[model samples]
Target: MENGKLDTRALIQTGVFTALYVVVLAVFGQLGALIPILQVMGPFYIPMVCGIPFMLFAARVRAFGQITIMGILAGALVFLTGQSWVVLALAVVLAPAADLIARAGRYRRFPLTLAAYVVFSEMLIGMVVPLFFMRGDFIARISQRHDDAWVNALVNLTPTWMFWVMIAMIAAGAAIGALLGRTLVAKHFRPAGLVT
Candidate 1:
């Protein structure tokens, strides 16, 4: 709080990971388009493996505002890319939560860092939460570009009842991703001086 600025290294690392998050999200988005099920299922699985850069940022950039800034940049990029901004909303919540989790570990605790990434992964479920409350609007919005058949398929595929299933998947995916990230941090990032 004294400086109100991230160190040069932290700033650069945040930019790198923020961009990484966007690129990974974009690739998964294409997969989502090719496989509609990915829209519902991708979050739980994708972050678990793809969050290497994120977990590295989490470990290395322990500045007070680092995670929040990185999250904002990532969210803005997602919105610019035309994905729903709902993930941005979730990032606001998840960023600080991740900070708290990392703080609990004293910033270098591997388990706690992994836990933080799990929180990062949780943001994916937020993408689907709108489906429960704004089903009609979502249908209407999608229908603008997509036909009735596709819209109907999406609606039927992601009913409110399935929200629970999606939540479970998100949790499972987060746990797996966190574990894998921990391994990566220990094996590569730590040795490479990327994470402390």
Candidate 2:
């Protein structure tokens, strides 16, 4: 009976954390619109901040399923709250990928795994999704606006440079998330007995 009670409490906590993640994403989405370029820039770090609590919760509770569910819920809530449905859909898809990468970290391999999380999350949510949703003419227009220099620069870089850049940004974001998560877990979650 005691074990059952603990399980119930943990579940409730998980739900609350998931809701919190959604709220954070919604808030960030509003920020993203106010600064669309920041959304594309790859190092905005908002998603990383949002993922921290969930990462810690996953580590302590060993509940990757709950974390993944929370990511989906976060994406959905962000969409329902007036974010673009296309981006929200991407978020729903990418959040699970991020959760998988984080879970694979097993609370360690911080650098590599977190990098994967960031890259995958950003590419899916930032680049590829936008590529599809945005009109080709818009991309061309932007390319022309830059005097073709931007596209030329990309063309000049190594074939995988774009991919690596995305990965690097993800790594940066994950590092930020990990640091903030540590602080938050220590300051609030630990004191509250919510995490180890």
Candidate 3:
């Protein structure tokens, strides 16, 4: 508690969770590439799968800036893998949102924690939205490296109306995930003294 620093145990837990989050992201990314329908429904998978680690991280760290660090690390890793910087930027933007939710709950409120997990999931999974917002620019960027047919395939897959539909799906996944996290927390983390 001195100087607002994390104790060693908390630091270790946060690091482990952050690494887990990145690994899961990478796995889902590869899976998305392999499966067309899977790629179209990333929101459903990312939030549901990744939200577990996020809730664990939030519970253990229970401090300011932990989510931000996790987001930055994930972003940096994604960038190193040759992905766009925009995803990183979105993650960073939403980190504070998670932080705020955690703070308001004092990091212990199950309901607020669930909400935080939902928002956190949105941060990482929402990166696909640039296609809907900046349609021409996104297509042009993809066209630079990918062939026109590839670009066309991508565009056709992501219809204009599907953007909001995807968001709703993500939110639904988040709710499902947060509920699962709550159950896990009550059954496992609390009993094991992982969360107070």
Best by lDDT: 3
CA displacement after TM-score superposition, residue 78 of candidate 1 (Å): 1.6
Relative to the true structure, how large is the alpha-carbon lDDT of every model?
Answer: 0.72, 0.56, 0.74
Residue 141 displacement (Å), model 3: 5.6
lDDT of 3 by residue, 104-194 (tens): 8777777887777777666655467667887888778768976876676677889988877887888888788777766787788889987
Task: Flag regions of model 1 displaced more than 4 Å.
Answer: 1-5, 191-193
Angstrom error of the Cα, residue 59, model 3: value is 2.0
For candidate 2, the per-residue lDDT at 16 reads 87
TM-score of each: 0.85, 0.60, 0.81
C-alpha lDDT of residue 181 in model 1: 70
Separately for all candidates shown, the number of backbone clashes (residues 3 or more apart, or on different chains) is: 1, 1, 0
Give each prediction's root-mean-square deviation over alpha carbons: 2.9, 6.4, 3.1
Q: What's the lDDT of the predicted structure labeled candidate 1?
A: 0.72
Better of 2 and 3 by TM-score: 3
Question: For residues 1-196, could you state the per-residue lDDT of candidate 1 as single tens digits?
Answer: 1123568876886788888877877776677665666766786767766676666666666466677777767766776776667878888899788877877766667778777777766776666666677777767777897787767777778877788877777767777776777778899988997654
Model 3 residue 50 CA deviation in Å: 0.6
